[model samples]
Target: MRLVHVVTLVSEDGAYGGPTSVATGQLEECATRGHEVTLLSLWRGGSRAPAHIGSVPLRTRPARALLPGRFTGIMHPLLVGDMWRSMGRADVVHIHAGRDLVSLTALAVATLRRKRFFTQTHGMVEPRHRLVARLFDRLYVPLLRRARGCLVLTERERRAVSEVIGPQGPPLLTLPNGVRPEHDAEVERGPRAPEVLFMARLHPRKRPDAFVETAALVHRKLPGVRFTLHGADEGELPTVRRLIAAHRLWGVVSYGGALSYAEALRAQARAAVYVLPSVDEPFPMTVIEALSAGTPVVCTDTCGMADELARRGAAVVTDGSPRAMADAVCEVLTDENRRAGLVRAGRRAVAESFSIHAVADRLEEIYRNL
Candidate 1:
């Protein structure tokens, strides 16, 4: 099978988060299975040429500002041309983002060429603002409807997209993002420290402030607890810094900015508990990585993987609040037996469902049927 994957950005460091990670993992797995795989992405931070993830080929174009907004997608004529050419040669086009301009361009080309294309909405269709939601409904919803199939991380997201696309929208497939199998071995070795770690972009949506508040609450209960916050500052660095100072958590809480992929996996392996306090996170790769490392996870109920993890007894799911998150963390920290059980369950869950090889096999079936 020849597959062409279209995404907004491709970074070795996972600067753009889970979507990039998912794309890289899936393409590599596809290539390993002897399927021809090519990635078309916008290169960030001054990448000149194509890079490879294993045998998969990644072609990128430097990004340029065409739209005016914080989350608005960029434009590159060369990328559009590249995508069009790739689609012409590929058996199927797999688009990774829904609301971006690159996705919109791919949709147009696929429609014009009458090609079969599948779209995976990385939970981008549900905008926070009413005005933006309305804009997406008008402009992006139709593009989604044109796909042969649409993929979502959770059933909740599928239902939401179904509401917008009505009865005649493209069929929605519920597919969770996957983690690399190498992390599974890390689960055997026990955590090196009694640390609670938060790793993601320090942005408003990620709720780094909530993590800080939760840290303070957890520290009040477990005074010896160490909290480490990792990831590059997006826009909420000042807010996180202010909260850390206001709570006087300088000694208890420390910020480790922007980790490499290897550093991140090592951090996950060494941490006792991994927490994601973000709201409406659609299948966070961090959660999967943490689980794969046999580290117990505490995340908000709104996270896409929350239900599945809780069902497997792999994590403690809480409401998106500091008090609730703190309580969940304390529960994991205080009970040695519970923590061990969670670690066991988390490793089992990842091995059975979220491994990249298994996910790629399922995806191959989908592509063949299409």
Candidate 2:
């Protein structure tokens, strides 16, 4: 099968976040299965072409900034042409992120070429502002309706998207993101350090400030514990810095900045606990990486993976509050038996359910049927 993935941005550097990681994982898995996979994405920083995501080909074009602030959309005219040609040669086109121009262009090209395409909303359809919600309902919702199938991370997201697209829209498939199984072996060796990791963009939505506050609280209980904040600074870096200084946790809490994909996996493996304080996280790839590395996790209950992990006894799901997160981290660090149990369960869950091979098998089935 020839598969093409259309996403906003992707780089060999660690500039991108979850969506790119998920796309790359799926593409690599599909390629390993003898499928010809191509990733069509906007190259960040500058124009780069003919890059390889392992064996899979990466074709990218320069991105034109559309808005002033961060998290703004990139306008890539070449994307439409690229998708038109790629879709003509491909068996299936998988579009990621619903509320983006790239996705809208892919849908248009797929329809024009009479090709089968699946659009996966990385949980971006929900709008917090009334004006944005109105725009999505008027414009994006119709484009989503044209997709052959829609993919969502959770049942909650499926329901929310269904409400907007109506009952007559494309079939929605629930597929959580998966991580590479090889990470389990590539993990850092020896005894894990007394470190808690918070790896995601420094955005308010991710609540890096809350992670800092939680770090302060945990430090009070476990003085030896260290907190590391990884990932690129999006918007909350200043706030995190302020909180770190205000709490006088200069050495106890340090920002490691952004790390490459491989580096992040090793970081996860080295840490005692991985923390995600985000709210309404559809599905975090970091959580999957943590579990795959046999590391326990402490995340907010609002996360999409929280319920499943909690049920499996693989993670400590806390309310999205600093104190609650602090307590969860403290418990996981202090109790040896509890930590061991979580590690075992987390590894089992990743192997049995969240491995990329299993996810690719399901995706291939869907693509074939489509």
**Candidate 1, residues 177-209: lDDT per residue as tens digits?**
888767656444653688999999988889988
Clashing pairs in 1: none
| Residues forming the 10-long window of minimal summed lDDT in candidate 1 | 183-192
Q: Give per-residue lDDT, candidate 1, residue 87.
A: 89
TM-score of 2: 0.94
Instruction: Give the residue spans of candidate 1 off by over 4 A.
Output: 46-50, 127-139, 186-191
lDDT of 1 at 304: 85
Model 2 misplaced regions, further than 4 Å: 12-15, 46-50, 68-72, 127-137
lDDT of 2 by residue, 1-370 (tens): 9999987777545566888888988999998889999999887653355488667798888767775434446657877788889999998989886566666667778888988889888887664457855764576677778888999999889987887788889999988799886777976677889999999988889999999999999999899999999988888999999999999999999999888788898899899999999998989899999998988999988899888899999999999799999999999998999999999899888988798988998999899886
Which numbered prediction scores highest in TM-score against the true structure? 2
Every candidate's lDDT: 0.83, 0.85
